[model samples]
Target: MISRKIILTFPQALLDKPIVYKLIKDYNLIFNILQAKITPDEEGIMILEIKGASRDYNAGISYLKNLGIDIRPLDQKIIWNERKCTHCGLCVDICPTQALSFKRPQMKIEFDKRKCIACELCLRICPVKAIEIQQ
Candidate 1:
């Protein structure tokens, strides 16, 4: 199966449509939502990971673009700067994927980029602005 992380930006007019639903039903793709903020009559944005066959994945992406959904591949990275981090663990609570964890013994904050889904939670929760997403 092909898996890809994507950031989807939907216009206010498309807010009422079942876009993700169609991606599942018609395109046969599995979508996992990492973070989302969608409201009717307002622009909606979502960070999602989609898994499917190569052909289906391509088709699904095409369908979204055809509907005017702005699709951006999450190909960059999220990183933690140890120099800026205080090891306070504030970012740990907001990370749903447990990508940010407190290492035992030292109680130091450790970031596992492999486990990160780029949800951007740590970026907002870090008071010191140590967490960064390299776009």
Candidate 2:
């Protein structure tokens, strides 16, 4: 089995389509939606974690690409600037996934990339602009 985190951008024309249903029904892929902002007649963005056989996963990605959906790796979208971080622990409190946490004894902040879901909550709460979302 293979698992990947990806961001999908849907054009306005495709906003009403059941694209995610196709990923499950046609490619037999399992998807977990980490974040989504979709509206009628507007572009939509979704952050998802997909899991399936390697073959199915590839097919699903190709299917999306063929339909002109813009896809990007989740890691490329969310960036944590270590140098700009102040270790104030403000972002740690807002992280829904606990991706950002305060490390004891050292009194420092820790980031676990694997646990992050790209929800963007930390991006809003960070005082020093340590977290950012790349288009």
Candidate 3:
């Protein structure tokens, strides 16, 4: 099986299409949507975690690409500037996945990339300018 996190932007023409449904019906892929915005004929955007067989994954992505969907890998990450971090732990509190944690003894913030869903909540919650989305 293969899994990937992706951000998809649907053009105005593709906004009405059931793109995610096509992935499931045609490629047998599992697409877990983390976030979405749809504006009828204007545009559609989604953050999704897709899992399926390798061949199916490839085919599903190809289908989206053919439909003019803008797809970006969500593997891009948030960078924590330790030097600027104040160990306030605001990020830890707002992290839905608990990907950010404070170590008790040393009072240091730790980040686990695997547990993060790229929700960007921590970026908003942090008091200092410590969390930055790496482009």
Candidate 4:
């Protein structure tokens, strides 16, 4: 099995298509939508974590590329500024996936990028403005 987080950008012309559904039905892929902003007649952006057999996952990605969907790795979307962080633990408490947490004994905060879903919860709650979206 393979799991990866990706960002999908849908052009206006593909906004109403059932692209994600096809991934499941045709490719046997499982997807979890972490965040999305879709507006009629406008560009759509979504953060999704997809899991499936390695072959199926590769095929699904190829299908998406063939359809003109802009795909990017989710790791590039979120930025954590270590210098500005105060380690107040506010973001740790608000992160749903526990991507931000306090390290034991050291009491320093740690950010696990793989576990982050790009939900933006931490961005809103960080007192020192340490977390930001990279666009």
Which of 3 and 4 is the better model by lDDT? 4
What TM-score would you give candidate 1 relative to the actual structure? 0.59
Model 4 lDDT tens row, 37-93: 653336777889999999999999999999999888866567889899988998887
Minimal lDDT window, size 10, model 3: 36-45
Give one digit per residue, the lDDT tens place, for model 3 in 43-90: 666789999999999999999999888888876688888999999988
Using all chains and alpha carbons, the TM-scores for the candidates as numbered come to 0.59, 0.59, 0.57, 0.58
Model 4 lDDT vs. the true structure? 0.84
Off by over 4 Å in 3: 39-41, 78-135
Q: Which lDDT tens digits does candidate 1 get at residues 1-135?
A: 999999888888887888899999999999998778653336677888999999999999999999998888877689789999999988887687789999999999999999987656567568899999785
Q: Model 4: residues >4 Å from true position, as ranges?
A: 39-41, 77-135
The lDDT, on a scale of 0 to 1, for candidate 3 is: 0.82
Clash totals for all candidate models: 0, 0, 0, 0
Q: What lDDT does each candidate get?
A: 0.85, 0.84, 0.82, 0.84
Model 2, global lDDT: 0.84
Please give, for residues 1-135, the per-residue lDDT of candidate 2 as tens digits. Answer: 999999798898898899999999999999999877653336677889999999999999999999999888877557889899999998886676789988899989888988887766677578789898866
Q: Identify the superior model by lDDT, candidate 1 or candidate 3.
A: 1
